[model samples]
Target: MGSVEVPSRHKALVYDSPGKISTKIEEIDTPKPGVGEVLVNLTHTGVCHSDMGVMCNSWAWLPAPTAQGQVGGHEGVGVVASLGPGTENSNVKVGDRVGIKWIASACGNCEPCLVGADANCTSAKISGYYTPGTFQQFALAPAHYVTPIPDSLASDMAAPMLCGGVTVYSALRKSGAKPGDWVVIPGAGGGLGHLALQIGARGMGFRMIGIDMGEKEQLVKDCGAEKFLNLANYSRDDEGTKKLVEDVKAITGGPGVAAVVVCTASNVAYAQGLSFLKFRGTLVCVGVPEGPSVPIATANPAAMLAQELRIVGSAVGNRQDAKETLDMAARGVVKTHFEVQPMDKLTEVFERMDKGKLQGRVVLDLSG
Candidate 1:
């Protein structure tokens, strides 16, 4: 495959103010792919909550604050417009559809990469952070690392699956719940939660219980949750937490769920996550809480020993996980509930997302 008609400049959405909710559309010079890389002509990108975290410099765990004018997006889908040196014999070629995810590139020689944990790669370049990201007309990805979008899936639908879908799927895989087991998901109507519900119930055959606000009950059930718990009904106090835990246990017939996947950024969800798991059950943490870090209040030593509970943290998926996730979407096993918006609406999308007003994911059309 040969290079296509490449543009010298293209439009991109940049974080004008690093510590606030602001984005500006600017025409930046298009970049050529380096050796063993491919330039992707992105047509669609998903606006993730993590992107907001980056823009606001909220996540303390990140090494440094986000710089102004950084393109802030990780879930981008498009086609290969050109390939650089050393990629001539690679599987990816010009015009082949692909997707870029959170972990932009990982040094294959790192310890984490050797263990197949790309998300924790010591030298990982995170998309939409210091490295240039997908919220633009074109972006570059390593030839060997880019996720190939399934031919049967549309670009708009494939965008959110790159991050939200793959993250939840990887978390579900780490959850240790088998088919027919009961699994609970906190924030089940949010972007990652809804996908977890569908993948857990339909793709993996787990009996899913969803927890969220009252308004999201129907959407949660529609996404394959066998039971829905309204967060609004329970107060944010200890007694209220006890009641919620009891309810979850009751729904699972006195024994708690086989696993609890906390998919929301709320610290309250993490505090209650371990309580909903049965003996020897697992609690998989997939959400990154904003602001100062807080320990899980319910994760006491005595309780952990008594129940033999296991807790694990999952980041975004690796290359293989991304492939499986897209395959699932291709087969109609999982679908993201999303609305398409133009590039200029990026700021409004972040504003609504920050307030929890978004019902599902939002995909940005980069055509404008």
Candidate 2:
């Protein structure tokens, strides 16, 4: 590693208002990492749907809407530019390649942190939400919390894994479906779902059934799904639900799938997800619907009792999950379909995302 020039100011995407897509690139003072922190000169950052949620203030469950003027991005990949006055014990040094995730910093002394569930820490700092995020060219990250990106993985691909990959990886792990089990991933062509399909199929040895529109059939198949279900072919009524359930059962050899990971924010996806699960099956919820949308239709206790099903909610993954996901990417077991774009084109990307036109993830090239 070699010494690099440090800039006094850097360009950043600043949120202009709380509940809209108003952002402007402004030159802000570059921050110096305090004790126990390192400054990362970010090369690429993935534009995630959650970033849209924060910028728009759509989710009511958050502690509060994202404050105005906050920089919004969590999946940032870059090289360390400098280290703070830590007196040298953090095991991280200048020039090391690292990545920052959704969970910026968590108190390790908390109960959840002690058990390696730092995402649920009592006092956790969220990057791009409550703290300064990766939308800027340089950002400060906690030394112990930032993940080291492998040399084999390119920064553009590694950026999305820091959030979408690790998230769905953790969700699948929590689903408890073993190798050879039939696991279905709805919205299997989107950012998180596509990575989940690859990780579950190639890396974890599970047989994947990807459900999405007809247009994503090839993408889902290319990502290693054994079967692809085009949701557009089915109706949203009771008959459509029954047809989908029967289709899944037939694909799984007369029994329902062992688990179903719902990776889309569509309420209809959630309403139809439980029908794909087998007895004693698990349903892992990874995507959050905006506002007070329709609740899950299978939330009734009677239905849960009859099927012996388990429903679990998963937030963004922990550090271990991040490492494992990046390792999988480095080993070529999984890969992200992304297009690199200049930072100024972010608004157009968001428009595509809102219209359900994006095929996969989009990585922003901050250098431009």
Candidate 3:
């Protein structure tokens, strides 16, 4: 097979202590790719909130606590370094740029895989969890599963699109809102929300309403949100929720928006989701709430039946969704607002993300 000069060892950022924000940079031996896998020389990886959840052991839905010394990142972009056995017919080869997403590998024979719901595949291996992830210089991904990076898109720019971009696009599709319909995103200026706004407005033709802090107003508007609602302006009380619902109805004529895609982990956003949708509208749950899982406050059967509303959970997108998302990026219909940081700053980046201080996404330069 074609090859590149790969070193024996490489730098990796690992979660030194799970259930907390601690990371250590260490040199570890790089392994050769196994069957149907490719060794990737990762140049850039996006630091996502999901990684923070994995490190902190905060997401209750996960099967188990993250193991110590686990490399933690999913949105990785790199070039193929070497091919493993039985990959001669694969679409990717040595020197081709590719990306690894949340789902590192999936058994193509699974029911979910057959239906294009790879995130729910029974044998799915999630990167940055139990599987070795992309917070390292070298990582292994299935040759058939890696996403092809478009020539027009830079690796750093394409990193976040692998996870956050495709995730929101999938959630938007599940939202069931058509062109010219009004859709609400709770964390509209966030890493996922900003991309959702751009894709919904520019790519899918939906009119977006962004809800976030006052500081995020400009960014949300710039990302194509037709209206920005400051979350701080509304108190977390019944009266406040009523007022917000009324305001949403006023903004979208009478009833309410066609859908409310909650992109924040805040339970308050999930509670307010159902109240923002019109009759027969959908509430697509995208963000995973950390800590103990709580039921949505307004998801009672009465409320659900009153409007014939539907609520669906969306994980990361499938391979087709990833391709479509990248296509949109290559065509300039969507763009991620991000800052580049060295690998050592990952802890600080996670801290900022935990405190809701990040403006968009942060791509780690793994070359360090």
Give candidate 3 misplaced runs (Cα > 4 Å). Answer: 1-3
Alpha carbon RMSD to native, model 2: 1.1
Give the per-residue lDDT digits (tens) of candidate 2, residues 128-176.
9989899889999999999999999999989999999999999999998
**Poorest 10 consecutive residues by lDDT, candidate 3:** 1-10
lDDT of 1 by residue, 1-368 (tens): 35567799999999999999999999999999999999999999999999999999999999888998999899999889999999999999999999999999999898889999898899899999998999999999999989998889999999999999999999999999999999999999999999999999999999999999988899999999989999999999999999999999999999899999998999999999999989999999999999999999889999999999999989998888999999999999999999999999999999998889888899999989
TM-score of each: 0.98, 0.98, 0.98
- The digit string of per-residue lDDT tens for model 3 on 1-368 reads 35678999999999999999999999999999999999999999999999999999998878888999999999999999999999999888899999999999999898998998998999899999999898999999999999999999999999999999999999999999999999999999999999999999999999999999999999999999999899789888999999999999999998899999988898889988999999999999999988777788888899899899999989989999999999999999999999999999999999999899999999999998
Error of 2 at 96 (Å): 0.3
Extract clashing residue pairs from model 2: none
Model 1, runs deviating above 4 Å:
1-3
The lDDT for every candidate, in the order shown, is 0.94, 0.90, 0.94
lDDT of 1: 0.94
Candidates 2 and 3, the one with greater TM-score? 3
